[model samples]
Target: MRLRPPDRFGSLVTLRLLFCHGAVDFNVGVTTGGGGMTGFSTSDLALLLYQAAQDKNRWPVLVAALQETANPFDDDAIYRNPAARRELLDQLLPHISQALDMADRFESQAVSQNLLDRTLEMLPMGVALLDDELNIIMLNQQADRTLAEHEMLANHDGHFKINNREQHKLLHHYIERSLEDGSSHALMLSPGNPRSVSLLVCPADLVKDRDDNDPPAVTLFLSNPDFQSLIDEQTLTDLYRLSAAEAELTRDLIHGYDLRSIAQRRQVSELTVRTQLKSIFRKTETARQAELVSLVLSGLAPLRGRESVTAKVADDIGESTGLRYCKGAHGQRLCFAEYGDPQGVAVMFCHSVRGSRLEVPGGDSVLRDMHIRLIIPERPGYGDSEALDERTVDDLAEDMRCLADHLELPQFHLLGYSLGGFLALHCAARLGDRISRLGLVSSLAPPGKEAGKPLKGMMRLAVALADKAPGLAETVLDHMARTILKNPRRHLGSSVDRKLLAEPDHQERYLLALRESCRQGSMGFVQDLQAVARTPLPEPSSLALPVYLWHGEQDGQVPADQAIQLDRWLTNSELTLLPDGGHFFIYSRWPQILANFVAE
Candidate 1:
């Protein structure tokens, strides 16, 4: 077949180009935007026209500008010209593809950089990136702070010496190993400084997709041992659902002590200790001892300690056989110990708000051994006593009235401690005709702004914070214990009695009382504080009964001034102050106080 030269602007230019040099009869077509012609050979014509356009210097400028500009093909002049449009599309398509490829690479690089930045920022420990030759590539913010603080990393070279050579060696070994194995590794680091930090060293290579030839980098997570102290009490309490007693148990458990050892230290039987442990386990959902220990170490456990003397007292009380139950006003069940003839002088002993009938210091032995008829009712929400729907001094007095009626006693002696003291006073006032004597030991009266300013503030703050963020209760309590309870000069002191208070046995009882109160959902504390803030007392005047008040000079929570104020307010009342004592002075000097009360 004879070959014909392709005509300029040929309609079948593309088809001729395709089959002219071959036997294949394939037909090709091309379409230009301005649309002069479309056939098998049109693509060849378009290519020629585009090449001609490119020969002009304006083609490179136009193509480069189009690549740089936002929307290149939307220009009207390029769309209108047939040759210009074809030429532009040919050039623009390849350029646009190259530009898109570059943009994708840039975006991927940015995303990776962002991920690396976020990872570094979130780390609590210092992190360093090093090159294969041991040159510093980068240092995270934490690393910068640490190195700058220690005067290390002064030079850009990766030759900084950690304060502890042992830790540094270990870290270096881990880094070397991770580089060799191309796997993530870890090590512990301890700096010898006062801010002695415990650190976990981890290989950073796990975060990146890199080969063995890539230099090893490490991330160090710093932990402060003292940070355990900073954890709030409420947080621990809520986290572990710890009652006061369980908090004490947790402390012993964390110290690697067994339940029996803890029981011995607290002067309680092992079974009692086990019971407390079971309660703790149920609340915290911990089945193993190790998990409990970890919870304590992580500050997820509450503050709990053992009190030996209190536990001993509890043991003695548990041995008592005589048990009597009386129905108090407000439908409360009051349990008491009945000894001697019922017709004899009836004595009613009220324990502190955080106390139960079984926890009246030496009341049980005193009543049994002295041949006295004592009516020791478990206060509302305590022991066998029914929980009060509402907590108020008036409600407590009403309850007492019911007990008096239920027991059918015409006259009775009244004794109370701390919160019990205020209740005792109310009982005396309400049952003036039926009471014989009134005694207050380590008792607190109603608190006014001047009396309990700090305490009231603390309570208000606690309630507010708890309401705002219930999770922080344990943390708040922890801080309060350390700052308020641990300070000897403050309400909580380190006197002999105070030291004893920290004992395992004493703490167990204290915690038990607290836990019981909490379980009952009795807002006795809040109500008591509110009553104290509101109640007003009169000047000393002769009463129908004799009143005696006892307090410790060093009493912190309820200042000795409160006792003095009560004494001055009651005409028949006399105040006896104890030296080197505190809120729970009666516990330490129980024998002497009881002797005086019995003699009277």
Candidate 2:
């Protein structure tokens, strides 16, 4: 599709090009308008685009142009009527979606790379195939079309040649050197032209269907400075179901327009823009505009094999748990489960000895509503994480630092229940800079520090064995894993705390969570009990991180006195004492706990 010269037309021509397949963009073709449009005014841009819209193949290009030029408020004149612009956008979405589907289908076909040659035709950049002798074998549609419009360059006998003598000789030398050395070379092409162009000569594997003895050739991947593949507003609208204003806000945000500029450009009050920005956040499941920008820039707009970004996230990141594994310093695989908003306030949830990644009753909805990203990271030797015999309580903070670095979480909140609380306290103290707030619910004080009462019955005996003899503790845990705890329902009435399991549904949830926790082995269970009795943690008052301590007054396992002592030890701590609460006080206060996550 060759673009006609502006002189040939009665009006100014603004021809934006789009490669519907991948996100390849070139800015030079339509230089006088705006993004893809080469910077033209609203009415002039619309007329020029309407002229190209006559061709059915140019619809996606027009959509791309409409999206790009809508920014900076100048092109708002074209889309002055909000309803018309919205109706046009709604109509344009399905056409581009259909085009992408066709493109994807064409790519997966068993036919040889003749499709690749055809696809290069759709790319906006000037692509060329050359041999060892610098003789052009083929040029994609853009090369032919772009060269035809150029004055300093032309296609002579199917080979690219510069009109200037020195430039032609230099281009020839670069191509020959690239083919001979099997490397890549690049140069900028200007020759006092209106726009400078980036020219790259890179060695490429022979295209399929080539003769067996074909000499190694080079492919030129020219870059057009004006070509910027912005987020497809259609894809964002389809993915998030955002309103026209919301979608417009999202597009402008990705293009580096700040909130104040966006408000001024959109001709709306800052409050309205802020409202739309918030709506975009909720729809995209992101927390801030910074994240919204990153989400779009990361190619979350389904342009490739996937149909939608949300679907792509689910497929790759997993559903519910969103399980992921990364190697620790010792090369042990540490597992972490992610859920809720991807770019919300990150809160790490440390697991108990008898818990893995499963959320407690009513926890999921609360986290989702609170806009908090709960990160459930399995400790050493638990769940899918590797069991390290030498793994101590202090090592947790370092491991989590690495994990947070990988996930790009600079600072976040931390929550730990029961045995997990010990790990949380140590983490907060060690990683004081990274922790914004810390919550330890029904958490244990140091082994013998609880003043109310010691653990009773089988739990007392188990703790004793764990402290005196870890080997025997593992044996007992293994036996319980294979027999008593294996069928949680049968022992639900007696084996565990009945007060915590007052309801049938609670019993069932506990059972499932119990089963998932012990899915790997009993080694972590034994090691945890030993750590509970012997782990050395930093003094609470020495730490500066804000802490929230919640415990039940009537609790038997870890008594209320532990919470009191913890509160007293921490300089900045808030103690919430539940009068009739048990070790499982969190199950009833799930909503309140999540609501309290947000604060000044």
Residue range 271-367, candidate 1, lDDT tens digits: 9888888888888788887887776665532323222245564665553545578776655566665543344557787777556555556445555
Number of the top-ranking candidate, with TM-score as the measure: 2
Clashes per prediction? 41, 10
Evaluate residue 206 in candidate 2 and report its C-alpha lDDT on the 0 to 100 scale. 37
Q: Indicate the worst ten consecutive residues by lDDT in candidate 1.
A: 1-10
lDDT of 2 by residue, 248-273 (tens): 78878766789899989978899998
> Which candidate leads the pack in lDDT?
2
Q: Pick out the ten consecutive residues of candidate 2 with the lowest summed lDDT.
A: 8-17
Residue 519 miss distance in model 2 (angstroms) = 1.9
TM-score of each: 0.42, 0.45
Candidate 1 global CA lDDT score: 0.55
Stretches of candidate 1 exceeding 4 Å from the true structure:
1-313, 319-324, 332-345, 447-496, 502-512, 538-544
